[model samples]
Target: MDTNDLPFKKRNFANRFFDATVWDDFIYRNDDIVVASYAKAGTTLVQQIVAQLIFNSRDDVDVASISPWIDSVYPDKRSKLNLLEAQTHRRFFKTHLPVDALTFSDRAKYIYIGRDGRDIALSLFDHQNAARQDAPLSADKTPPSASGLKVLAPTQTSACDYFDTWLERDGHPFWPFWENLRSWWQVRMLPNVLFVHYTDLVADTGKQIERIAAFLELPLSEGRLPTILANCSLVSMRANARLYVPHGAGLWKDDGRSFFNKGQNSRWIDVLPPEMSIKFEKKAVMELGIDCARWMMLAGPVANASVG
Candidate 1:
């Protein structure tokens, strides 16, 4: 994959990290909204949620077009700024880069999604494999330069390779999961931005959708709220997956299915080995301060007294 295609801005760890020159035109306007997150963290899932709410739950709109992905790839920097400047009913966009790469528009509201690293590992694995399947392959099913360890394309590798790389200490496309969440977690406390958890969305999509609408201050008619809630559910989103295509700073091909996968959480319990689970848990505790091993304390299988 060509690194130039990524939408990331070049930066050295200095000068407080500002580069408005690249995306000045694409900065948020009064009507613009941002659905941002780390990859495999439900960026598309919440984009659909917001889109449905803004469109008044209309089924006729081309969601993908209405909510363009303004990442480093789609419109590039110049085109992205151009899109940001243009007027529309609302400007909806997706992003996977961390907060440092993003431009904070004081007036624009940002919605960030957070998910478990285990599910992210699984989802990312599937995402990479799907892309590799689309690329031209050798008889043995390897890309041209990726046959050996020398080639380090995310799209050219398997799930295990991606997971290993992601879990490692220092590598390109840095995991930075811990730092990413903490930075945005801080931003979330700001008045304009909202932070959402993926598990909550899965468990109670309806309520989560309502919370989203409330955050955006988008009014929802009584009937429309239910409609948007139903449409944005993982089941509904997966069934209508064809409506969303790949766009962004990555080479995910144009595969629409890439956005909506197994949507279930805690899948690592099924596939992750004992040793790997321990390592992943340790890293999560160290990096995210959440112990996957004992996360059940908050997410037990049993219903709480209120729900029960």
Candidate 2:
């Protein structure tokens, strides 16, 4: 519970897209909320959920501007730090870096979201493909140069092939999946950190939200659950994509529906080769051990379904 026991700054993480060093300069507040995830693992969905909770069910919470990716190596990145320092509202934001790369604070609450590597490969393929087609940075879109990493063009024509490269390269052209997943897994025992699975969020959003709300010590207003559930639903988010897509990166499409693609789990069942899946299984277990890996990909007891 003390700062000394929190995850330490063990290393720096940077790619063309993320810069963990950006966090070194960030000053922490007691009530800050940090949403951490390895890319495309429902980071934004939780952001949407948190926004609804913090704003008391009002639907227009501009999460994009308000919940900037604190560690993004985006343009004017330092200015974001300045802006965040100036914010007076109970501030929250997102980060794609692993726990080891971040400047953790005992006073701040942390939420980490995880998804199966197989599903992430498919989702990430769609996400990157859409980015290549888009040309502007609205309040919602991230520019090609944002992450500090070089632009990675889609090398594969299909999601299955993409999965092969993703598994073989370990999140190639983006970032390392195992390291990021493992780093967070190492800290799962921390009292200040909360892990959420993408499947759990999609399977029973109401229960998940209640868990997240409770973790952040937010009291659920009577009858607000329905509104929170409705707003955070994939259908609702896709229908009102503009509102949910965070600033610097929402969707490049005019409809923004591409960002929320399917929102269902296990889209990789028939798509990826079974052999490749076996490889991912070994990697997940090797990287995160069986217990953490199971809780992350599936959900339930054995750390299976606890929002804690």
Model 2, position 209, has a per-residue lDDT of 93
Residue 255 in candidate 1, Cα distance off native in Å: 6.5
The worst-scoring run of ten residues by lDDT in candidate 2 lies at 299-308
* Candidate 1 ranges with C-alpha deviation above 4 Å: 1-21, 136-162, 169-175, 248-255, 290-308
Give lDDT tens digits, candidate 1, residues 5-54.
22344442221111234543455567468887766777877888787877
Summing lDDT over every window of 10 consecutive residues in candidate 1, give the lowest-scoring window. 299-308
Error of 1 at 87 (Å): 3.2
Give the runs in model 2 whose Cα sits over 4 Å from its true position: 132-156, 247-251, 299-308
Using lDDT, give the best candidate's number: 2
Kindly list the per-residue Cα lDDT of model 2 for residues 62-141, writing each as its tens digit.
Answer: 78777888877665567788879889988899988877888888878989999887888888888767654433324224
TM-score, model 1 to reference: 0.74
